[model samples]
Target: MGALALLAGCGLPRSGPTRGEIFNGSVLREGDAFVLVVTDRVNAIASVAPALGFSSEFRDAGLVGSDIISPGDVLGLTIWENVSDGLLVPTGQNATVLEEVQVDGQGFIYVPYAGRIRAAGNTPERVRQIITDRLGDQTPDPQVQVRRVAGDGATVSVVGAVGAQGIYAIERPTRTLSQMLARAGGVAVDPEIARVTVTRGGHTGSVWFEDLYEPGHDIALRNNDRVIVEADTRAFTAIGATGAQSRVNFESQSISAIEAIAQVGGLNPSLADPEGVFVLRNEPEEIAEQLTGQDLVGTQRIVYLLDLTRPNGLFFARDFAVRDGDTIYVTEAPFTRINKAVSALTGTLGGVNAVSSAAQQIAGN
Candidate 1:
């Protein structure tokens, strides 16, 4: 008993929050700042949900043709005059050979009789009309054909962790973000855990690869749009009496607390306190009071308690969003500690009794 008492009192205490302290609602400290916000599903989602905000480059704009031309593109122009004595061509020549014309920096292409026409910001068909209209006065009803020789001006760049990384020309009528990704051989990592970012004009938005298949996810790509697929390294740490205590990477974009608990090996039946499943997180100081009643001063470490003993606790765990860098802890139950102490005492007494019995037998012998 004495040895057990000494053993229990000595050594270091458990390096984690207790069930009682967290259930009572308290603030965890770190350095000299208040950052934790332990709360229920409503508060937790509100506090950390904003980080998931991704502004999409493709908004409600429906699918659009990718035939919009830009400067530096090469255009093939062929002019055909029905009359044998064409004014634009020679007296005997009825057609002009295909002319390879490069759209200048000013978005203009020069033609023999059409003069310099705006072709950079217009589609190939639109440029053909412009050339035909210009040559109408020179030649009687000139039939003009404009073909895109090379796609050097308008292209979508696919960079980052993908099988094929390069600029893909958007020559189709409607080129979608998914099409560009497919052109790049999809993402190198798993689609569920990968993040795809689309930058168009001045707006940029990101979505998980799993969301790429969702409705409205296959947005149309614009000229000069950049699609970057990056590996998702976001993760959360699980400690205490869970199944396994270690950092677990986010297999998906987001996971519920119930799934997170299962990933950490679930609660340890022998040592976990059913009423003290806690999630520790750091939140913005502005919404601290609204989240929890605890008057947190520094390191606003919030300890959210989930009582698995209650009927609604397990149900609500599914709604809780496990944020990145969150700490999922299952505190040790009170009886668990008592059992350890009692087992030590029982072993010590059993050894003493065995020795005494051996001595008595030896004396009799």
Candidate 2:
């Protein structure tokens, strides 16, 4: 019987989350800062703050900056004149100057009578002051007002195996990358963290979600930006005496052998040959060819193996992460295969004897 057929006979159910869940959960709660820092040794700018309970007005303390601006933003402006009632009244019957006016490609907004005004790099209050100064001669004591239509235009892309994979818009001016991910829905049940790429201006960049929980390692976002959450579609082939021997979907870019086994509910306790377990990967020649063609090898296209019986194997199990398109084979013990063959032969001999005896009795009658 084929490996798949053998697996079907075992009646194994679906697999669930394992240690990978802890990493993914951490990413959703904190961010990708720590993971990046550990893997690449890069420094992040933002710091993680304690969660403020039941305080709606308190913004995430991680957000820092005196006055910063981004592109593709909108603003609302209201001009008022002092009134006898002590409440600010509209300068004219129509007090609103601009409503939801978008910033231009050059990061400038065209104001009425004020001509082209730079708004991209300036704060809302500063922009209002600039406009007020420009119109000082036209009105006597003109009170100007300005506010962001959409604040802190940092965005992160969500691609791959997700319910919704695309660019998610973030309105928090000081929100970190980790905060942006929560806004985009946490990683799917089977997440490939290594395959998760963060690109800036069409160039590849890295973010450390783990560091977000640490003191200082969170990075801020910019407007018109993108965050792609992609599902790692890599296929991992499982062979040998496992419960279900078939190709399992690896949601993340890297998966250790132990984790892979757990994903398939570990080796079937009754049938698995723990000592002979092996993972067959692409040959070095094959990898070199694939990489030369498109540079898709290296971390993204490597495979590994694990032996559960060895005590020290656990260390390698965690460190030897699997790459996309990896194959894991668990060889059955010699006795198991021999026993199956002997049982089949015995059953065949019994069936033949019964047929011969029945034929002779019919002929004699």
Candidate 3:
């Protein structure tokens, strides 16, 4: 029995004290709910201050305001003349007044009478005024109008774990980040909420989904902007005597080992060795070896064992957070494994006898 217990312990996972686990136990034991310390390094970036901007306090950058018009936008212009019968007439002999104009690569639109006029970066009303002024000498009371035709100039690219991934044209000038996501068909049906990354010119910025959804925290989209919705790459594998031995996606930045087990529907009570729960983590050297394919000298594998038999262990379970791709395994009790082995041996013998009898009958026939 002693030898069996030793084998069970060795086979079981190893658990060690974590920084947060130690801190929690120490601080809570002192009966202090609040603790403050002045340090040069602060975690202010994760916290968001709505009054200032939509960006988190920890983020060095601010939220993008609104999208502006750029060059190469197709604009539709129509000139109408008030006629005698309250009907608008085209100034041209063809009786066609409306003319669709394209803003050139240099942000200039050409009119019939007026030469190349710059319309890009100007509002519709501003463009209309500029057109009116330019054609003042040609016709009396020249009424010019300008409207956006093609939206190629103002576009946002949506990529990553969304239903649709591509560059979307922003019909409206003032398009928000949330609206752009909706146009991209939303995020995947996973715990990982979509992260929006906006790249403009050569500068890039990122914002979390929660920040965009929460009230008073709205980020604007810009023209010629690129929004990449990256897929959730991090995952946690739950194995051993769990209800479901599967890999659960690590959506949040942090997750406890117990929570990871619960994600797979917890451990199988009948076969689980509560005292032998273990978490297998790849050491830094192992990860480096796997990544670079070079043999790492003195590489050590890390295995954390947790004994869930004690009530105090529950506190550690909450504090011991698991990293992405970490494996959570609840080992089967020694007795259970023995029983399974015996059953497998018996089943194998019975199957062999049945096969042998069938072979003999065939040979006799």
**Strongest candidate by TM-score:** 1
Clashing pairs in 3: 13-305, 14-304, 14-305, 15-304, 15-305, 45-58, 159-229, 160-229
lDDT per residue for candidate 3 within 189-261, as digits (tens), equals: 4524455677767766666665667775566566677777665457888877888888788767567767888
How does each model score on lDDT? 0.74, 0.54, 0.61
List, in order, the clash count of every candidate structure.
12, 34, 8
What are the candidates' C-alpha RMSDs?
5.5, 13.7, 11.7
Better structure of 1 and 2 per lDDT: 1
Question: Model 2: how far is 168 from its true place, Å?
Answer: 9.4
Q: Model 1, 1-365: lDDT tens per residue?
A: 57656655554245366665564453242233333323354545433565432454365655545677788888887788988888566677767766578888888878876788888757888888888888898778899888888765468899999999998877673278777788789899987778898887788888877676777667777778888899887889999988899999998877988899998789888888878887777766655656655565544655666777777778667777888888888888876666667776787789999999999999999
What is the lDDT for 78 in model 3? 76
Off by over 4 Å in 1: 1-13, 20-57, 80-92, 112-115, 137-140, 159-165, 182-191, 285-289, 293-300, 335-365
Q: Provide the lDDT at 86 for model 3.
A: 19
- Pick out the ten consecutive residues of candidate 1 with the lowest summed lDDT: 29-38
Candidate 3 residue spans exceeding 4 A from truth: 1-72, 76-98, 111-117, 130-144, 148-174, 180-210, 215-217, 226-234, 250-255, 281-305, 332-365
Task: Tell me how far the alpha carbon of residue 70 in candidate 3 is from the true structure, in angstroms, after superposition.
Answer: 5.0
Better of 1 and 3 by TM-score: 1
